[model samples]
Target: MRWFWKWYLWSEDWKVEGSFPYHLKKMVIIVAPHTHWKDFILGVAVRSAYRFTYVKFLGKQELFKPPFGFIFRWLGGTPVDRRNNNNLVEAVVQKFNDSESLVIALSPEGTRKKVEKLRTGFYHIARQAGVPIMMVGFDFKNHKVIFDEPFMTTENEAADFERITNFYRPIEGKIPEQGLMHF
Candidate 1:
């Protein structure tokens, strides 16, 4: 069942650089142009393929329900009650500190819709954790998954997002709804 889903849902086009560097033992991965929900499956599939067994990610607290919650939790979903406290950065940083080799995955878009300003949580988390930030490109344009160079947040949201977006400019197949948020 897992193999079937992976074959159908995940991208067939992939380019790996190398094993997650040992120096980057602890890091945050930023997934950009998060214009569609399908990226979740692709992300999980890639993680499994690379044997990246331990990953942590944020999701709305509401999604943590019953059977679905069990599956999500098994796959590293950490529920966040953003409405009560919007300080996900601090919470995620704490999680990093709790784990030996944690890798938190974040979607800068923050949703499956267009947004003018990218969320800055990933930047702050990476900085607070004192770890490198790696880029995971969904490559909707070319139907691929790419692992690019790692970076460290410079606390410059606008410029940093631009640099990250440009790195994915070559990718195609971005959904039309993502147009408004295009860089």
Candidate 2:
């Protein structure tokens, strides 16, 4: 699988940027500009290429149903019921506390459609779990999977979001119209 991903990434001309922080025992990774489903496949290839078996990703409850659910689970995906009134952050935080070493990657945009601003769940989850936040950008325009250095959350959320925005601003998603438009 790792060799396959290495070939796939090379065949697709995708370049992974930055040194992955492999030493972190736990982290909340945020992947930005998720404007298409292909991002998930790209993520899988990259994960395999990097041998990131400890990292887990969340998928909608719908994706976790039927015969396909098992496949997702096998790929380290957890079913997330993102419906109203669910204490999702608390639940995710608990997963961190329960695990000795875990890395959960979440999409800050939370949807495939265009969003005015990022959803704050990823930030709050990292803050509450006492884990560092690692930002990853899928730059479709440049065909790059860029990883940022992990940093712990701070008290000022607005500032943190500003920093996140700046990091993803230049990266184009699969569907440029549905992703965060650059200012």
lDDT string, candidate 1, 63-145, tens digits: 78885888878889888775765677887788788888887787766776777766778788888988888877776655667
Task: Give candidate 2's error at residue 58 in angstroms.
Answer: 1.1
On a 0 to 1 TM-score scale, where does candidate 1 land against the true structure? 0.81
Tens-place lDDT digits, model 2, residues 55-172: 9998788888988999999888998877875999999899899999999998998888898888889999999999999999999999999999998889998888888998988889
Off by over 4 Å in 1: 1-23, 155-158, 179-181
How many clashes would you count in candidate 2? 0
lDDT: worst 10-residue window of model 1: 13-22
Question: Taking the candidates one at a time, how many backbone clashes does each contain?
Answer: 3, 0
Give each model's whole-structure lDDT: 0.71, 0.90
